[model samples]
Target chain A: MEDEPSSRPAGRPRDPGVAARVLTAVQDLLITNGYAGTTIAAVAQAAGTGKAAVYRRWSGKADLVVAAVLALNAPVSVPDTGSLRDDLVECAMHYARGDERATRVLASLLSEIGHDPQLFDAANRAIGRPPVAALVAVIEQWVRRGAISADVPTELIAGIIPTAAFGSVTLRQRTLDTQTISDLVDHVLLPALTGAHGSSTQLL
Target chain B: MEDEPSSRPAGRPRDPGVAARVLTAVQDLLITNGYAGTTIAAVAQAAGTGKAAVYRRWSGKADLVVAAVLALNAPVSVPDTGSLRDDLVECAMHYARGDERATRVLASLLSEIGHDPQLFDAANRAIGRPPVAALVAVIEQWVRRGAISADVPTELIAGIIPTAAFGSVTLRQRTLDTQTISDLVDHVLLPALTGAHGSSTQLL
Candidate 1:
C-alpha cells in the first residue's frame, strides 16, 4: 500500500478497506433512501469512516452513486467465442442478469436522471458505455473475419442486444430469459446485421 | 351542469375550467420540478386555483402526475390498418414522438417508480396499461385473421414496439425516429411474429 500523502493529518493511515466498505454503504443507502435521502454524512457513518474519507474518493452523491452502481454491476468481461452469435448472446446476458440491488438502484435512479444532468452523465459513463464498448470490440472482430456485414453500423449492431434486454425490463419489469436472448441474437440481431431479414431501406 | 351536493358550503360553483387548468399546472410542475419537487401547494399556486380545488380533482401527487402524463400522451386510438406491422408501427410511433414536456416528465418519474408503490401503480394504470391493452387487442385481431402465428405469446408480441422505443430513450436519451421504428417493426417484429427470415425457435 502507498503511504499517506505528506499533507495528511497526523494519524493512523487510512484503511485500504474503507473504499469498498463505503461503496457498499452508498449502494445500500441509495437503494433504501433514494437520491434525495442519501447523504455523505450518512454514508460515512454507515461505513465507519469520516466524511472526508468518502469525499476523498467521490466528489458528491452523483459521483458516489455512479461508483457504487458500477461496483454492484462489476465489469462485464467480453467473451470471445469466435461466433458473433455466441459473443452477442453472452454480451446481452451480462445486462439481462443484472443483480437485484443494481436493478433496484437503477429503477430508483431513473426518475432523477432527467432532473439531474450530473447523475445522468455519471450513469452513462460508468454503466452504459462499457457494454457498448465491449460490444463494438466484438463486432469489429466479426467484421475482420467477414462474419458480420461491414456495412452495418457498429452502434446499431451493438444497440440491439442490450436494448432488447432493456426493453423487456422497462416495459415488463422482467429479465431477458435464455430463449429471449437467443431469439434477439438469431432472429432480430443476426438477420439485421447480416442484411438477410427485410429490405435495407427499413433501417436507419 | 350538475348542482353541488345539498351539504355543499354555499359559494360560487366550482369553475368548469378548473380540472383542465389544474392538470395543465400539474404537467408544468412535473416537467419542471419532477415528482419530489412537485407538491400540492406548488401545483395549486401554478394553476391559480385553491388547494381544495386541486385536492378535489386528485387525491395526491401520484394521481395528479399520472393524470398529467396520460393527458400529455393522449390516448392512442389503435388504427385498423388491417396489417399487424402497420398497426404496431403506428402505435410505437405514438410514444416515440412524445412532446418535450411529456418526455421530461416521464424521464423524471422513472427513477421514483421503485420507491413509491402508489406512483408506480398509478403510472402503470394510466400511462403503461393503455398501450399494452391496445397492443393486445390488435394482436388478438391479427390472431383471429391468421395474420400472426397463434403460438407467439401475446405479451411478448405486444411488448416489442413500445419496449424498443423505451430502450432507445432510456439508454441513449434518443427517441425512435421513423426509420428506426419502421426497421424495428419490419425486421424484428414481423420476422418474430411471422416465423419468416430464419427459424421460429428464436421467438419468445
Candidate 2:
C-alpha cells in the first residue's frame, strides 16, 4: 500500500498521475459493477495501484465512488450560449446525448446518496453547486432583460433544469427523444415559470 | 424453509396472505437496503418466511423486489381535475408521495438493470408498466377535454413524468418537494403537453 501519489512532480518516478488514473478507473468500475458491487480492490486493480495507494486518499468504497462520479458528472461552468434558453438546452442535452451507461452510473450513485445523504456531500458540494450557480447567473440575465420574470428564483428553480435534463434517462424507462426534451424546456418549464397568464384565457 | 403462505383467504386462514405479506416486506427492504443489499434471505426474514418459501415464488431477488415495488406503487388512478394543469399537478404530487426510499431503490434498480435488462423484464411487465400507464390515461383525458393538444403524444410524455419526478430527488440531492413537483408539472411539463402557444413570449 503506497501513499497517494499527488499530481505534483516527483523525484523518484512516482507515477504522479496515480490519483487521476485511479479516479478514472473508479468511474469505469462504477459504470460496470455499480455502487454496491464496486470494491477498493477492483478500483486498485483497474487503476494499476495498490490498495494502500487508494486508502491514502479515500476513506472507503463510498468515498472512492463520490470522487469518481463527481469527476465525471459534476457541473462545470455554464457555457455562454448567448441565449438563456439555448444555454440551458445545451446543458440538458449534454446529458441527453446518448451515454446511457454514464447516466445509469449517476442514477445509481444518486440512489445511494439518497439513502445515505452524506455519502456524496463533498462530491455534491464540489459537483452539484457550481453549475447551478452558473445557471443562476445566466437566468438572472433573463430576469433583468424582462424576457422572464424577476420573481422567479433561479437558484431554486434553475437547479431543476439540469436535474430534469440529465435525469431524463432515469425518468424514462427507455431513452429520451429530442422533442420531449425540447417540450420539457420550452413548454413545461417556461410557462409555469413565467406564469404565461394571458395565454390560457386567449386559448379559450 | 416453509412455503410462502398462499394469497390471503376470505376469512384469513390457509396462510393465504403469504404472497401479499412477502411482497410488502420485500418492498420495504428495497427502499431501506436498496437492490443490492435486499437479499432473498433478508426478504424472507422481514416477511417472516423461510428462504425456501421466497424461492418458490420468485426465481431470484430481482423478481421479488420488482413485485414488491409494483404492488406498493400501483396505479392509484388520477381524477380529472378539470384542467390539464390541475390534473398534472395532482398526479405529480401523488407521484411524489410514496416510499421515501423509492428514489434510492429506483437508482439502485436502474443502475443494475442495465447490466441485465432481461432480469427486470418481469418487473417491467408487472410492476413497471401500470403506474405510468395510469398517468398516460390521465393525459388522454386532458386531450379529450381539449385542455391539451391531441397531437401531444401524451403517452410518451407521461412516461417520462415518474422517472423525472423520482430522478429529481436522486440527482439533485433533495427531496421531491411539493413546489418542485408542482413546478415540474407547471414549468417543464405542462406547456409541452398542453400546447400553450406563445408561452415563452408576450412582451412582459
Candidate 3:
C-alpha cells in the first residue's frame, strides 16, 4: 500500500498532530473492533479527520494498521553486555516488560495478518525484524570473540525469546515474569548458543 | 463450554451425523467469515439444522469452533524412533504436512481465542496440549536413558517444535520446509536438549 504522493492534490502542509491522532485512533479501533471491524471511515471519524486525510497518509487499512502498531512499539535498545548470555537476558527482559495494551492490539491483528501478505510483511517489518537484527549483531560479536560457535544459526538463536514472548501473550494469555525469562535464558538460549548446559545455578 | 448432557430435554436420541455436519459447517464458515463474523445461527443454517440442534451439541460459538478445529486436525502419532532427534523430526514433519484449510481456520480463530479464556483453554486442549504431551513423553524417555540431562525443562523442550511451527505458519505465513525443520532440530532443539551442538552434517 504505497502512498502516491504525486496523486494527492497540493494541499496545506500536513498537520504533524493529525498523524499521531490518526495512529492513536487506529490502535483504539484495533483493540475495540479488531482488524475486520476497523475501517478507514471509522478510524477517520474517531480521529476527527476527513477520510481523505487518512488515505493521504496510508493507502489502505493494512498500511494504516501496520503504522499504528509500529508507533505503539518503542524500539528495543540493543544491549552490549560483554557476555552473550547477559546480552540475551537483557533483550528478553525488554520483551517481557512490554505493556498489555500493545500485546492486545497485536493479538487482535494476528488472524488478519496471517491472511494478508501486505499486512504480514508490514507487521514483520515493524515487530519482527528489529529485535532479530539486534540479537544478530550481539551474536556476531560473540562469534568473533570465539565465545560461541560460528556455525550456530544466528537468526534462529535470536528468534527464541521473541517467539516465546509472543506465544506467551498471544497464545497463552500470560505475561512473561522475571523467573520465566531467567529460566528461558539460563536453560534454553544459553545452552543453544554455547553448546553447554546453561550455568543455571551460577546465573540464578 | 462444557456440554451438559443432563440439561437436554428428554428428546430423540442424538443424531451422530448432525455433529459431523455442524462441525463441517463451522470450519467452512470460519475459513470464509473469520471468528468475529461467524455466528451460531449462520453455522446452523449452513449445516441445514436448527439452532437448537447446534446448541444441544455445543454450548455456544466458542465451543463449536474449538470442536471444528479439533476435528480438522488428525492426532499426531507419537513416534518411538529410539532417538529423540528422530522422534522430533517425525513430529515436525507431521506439523509441516498439515493441510492449508486447517491452518486458515486456526489463523482465523487466533484473534478471538486470545480474548476469550474459554476459547483459549478449549484451543489449548485441542491444538496445543497433545503434541506437547507426545514430545514430553519422548524427551522423558531420553532423560531416563541418560541421553539428556534431567535438569532440562521437559515441558519447555516439548514446546519448542510446536512453537516454531506455529510461528512459522501464523507469524511468517510460511510453512516449515523440510530443510528448515532439519535445521531447527539440528541447530536449535538438539543443542538445547542435550547441551551439544546438533550434528547438522550427520543429520542432513
Top-scoring candidate (TM-score): 3
Evaluate model 1: give its lDDT. 0.67
Instruction: Give me the candidate number with maximum DockQ.
Output: 3
Candidate 2: tens digits of C-alpha lDDT, residues B1-204: 355345535574445566887887776776667676788888788777778767777888766766765664555577676656666666666656754454555555665555566535645664456667767878888777777777665655675556555556565544566765665555556655653422223111
**Native contact fraction of candidate 1?**
0.28
Ranking of predictions according to DockQ:
3, 2, 1
Quote the lDDT for B36 in model 1. Answer: 76
- Tens-digit per-residue lDDT, B1-204, candidate 3: 222244556774766877888899899988788786799988888887788878777888777887887787557677888777888787767667756566667667777775677766667776777777777878888888999889888887677777777777777666667787788788778888887766656564
- Tell me the TM-score of each prediction against the true structure: 0.75, 0.75, 0.86
lDDT of 3 by residue, A5-117 (tens): 44455774666887998899998998788787899999888888778888877988778888898887567677887767778777777666756566667777877775677
After superposing candidate 3, which stretches have Cα over 4 Å from the reference? Answer: A1-14, A50-52, A70-74, A100-103, A201-204, B1-14, B69-74, B100-103, B201-204
TM-score of chain A of 2: 0.72
| Preferred candidate (DockQ higher): 1 or 3 | 3
